[model samples]
Target: MKLIEALPIVLSCQNLSKSFRGRHKQETVVLADINLEIRKGSFVTILGQSGGGKSTLLKLLGGFLPPSSGNVLFNGQSLKNNTPDIGMIFQDHNLYPWMTVEQNVGFGFRIKGEKPGNYKHLVHEILDTVGLSHARKLYPHQLSGGMRQRVAIARSIVVKPTVLLLDEPFSALDVQLRRRLQEFLLALWSEMNTTMILVTHNVEEAILLGQKLVVVGSNPGRIVEEMTISDIQYRDRYHPDFLHVQRYLESVLEGNLKEQGDNYYEEVLAISRIQKINS
Candidate 1:
């Protein structure tokens, strides 16, 4: 077994489902029977299109939204509500416009009634790690989109959350900036070893960052496919194997490859072999 597979399960959901009551008491099922297990210190990416309940699944996992049925387990305990141990970052930076970078990153400590002297060093440390130490005095309006996002991330990680749930946090940035942030996030995860689950509609981003990728299908979102990718080749966007898998996943998301089961793996492995021979 892979080392990541051997790690203890840090978070999981059992038969998790969520529904909302709409007008005339109509029930709209956003998610159904989502059973997932995240390993300790692993990076898991959830891929799906918009309105596919990807965000809802993330919220349910984080206890930001309660599941209509089933349970979210954290460290083997059923999660009743959002806990500090699980931090969340959304697509929007959602920074405090009035607070400077330093103040904003330190807000988590302040909200917990911690004194400045208690968390000041921690706030500085995280800011430096995120490459925002020099921008500590800048307010939200003064920072660039990427910088604001970095501050938001710093804010979440400064508290040392065991798991971080991100909801398309880089979707708004330009392609170049998005890639940079993806690398930044991966580096931070490596350093912190925090189990990270990020939900995104971007296929390349999902494969690039995830050790495990779970694809959620729409029409009451469900896991259509789950893949464990360990090969470093998958990390290269231009690699033949990487492109093959990306195209296959794209087809799956577009509802074209539903019946392609074992053939998918065979094709990907075949491509890997071809590349190895050519190299």
Candidate 2:
């Protein structure tokens, strides 16, 4: 692992485990014996199959969900509950219907007893930064999907959260929009320097957005693979180096899912269409 110099470890988990009771006291484990560390200003992506406990792990790290065993530490302190220093963006933007763009973006500050006069400049600055200044007066219903998501990002980040946890924020958007938003997110990360951990099922998207990618396997979920891609050349989607990483991650996820069943063959077919196979 190529550790980023001068960056402090902002998040850490040790021997994490989460399970739930189902079917007459049958314990169904989601994640077990998991360990991970996220450094300040790092972009980490979590990839796995549908039932592979990807989002569950994110919740655990963020303290939105408690682990059945072990613990998660935020900046060397145990994370007991959701903290303002750690922000979260869900798949759904969840903007209030009546709230304007600026209102939604500054909502975090308002809830914390911060007057609008204090956060007014910051809200406008973030709105203009995300290219949503013109729509600041517009409500959630008035904005398009991409614009709404931008608002969501602005909302989570305006408060200057130490770390941001995103649960597949762009999964609902179409391909082109998703890429555009991905670029937008990268720009935000560059400017804000917030440590981000994103959970997604899209291998290509994961490869495009993350500095470090972690693959989680099902049946008592655990980290099966981890890769660090700091070289900018691999960011190009069409580059062989980029495709090689994508193919490798797809193969890992496919092999892990194949044991579950062949019913989920669409992923294999989609990957095969992009990658040539030796006959």
TM-score per model over all chains: 0.92, 0.88
lDDT of 1 by residue, 148-242 (tens): 88999999999989999998899879999999889899888888879999998899999899878899999899998877776778779999878
The numbered model that scores best in lDDT is 1
Prediction-by-prediction clash tally: 0, 0
Candidate 2 least-lDDT 10 residues: 270-279
Model 1 Cα shift for residue 5 (angstroms)? 0.8
Tens-digit lDDT track of model 2 for 1-279: 223434789999999999989989999999999999888998889999998898889889989999999999999999999999999987676998989999999999999999999999999999998899999999999999889989999999999999999988998899999988898888888877799899999999898888778999999899987666666655799987678678768878887546544644455344433332210
Clashes of 1: 0
Give the lDDT of residue 218 in candidate 2. Answer: 93
Task: Give me the candidate number with maximum TM-score.
Answer: 1
Residue pairs with clashing backbones, model 2: none
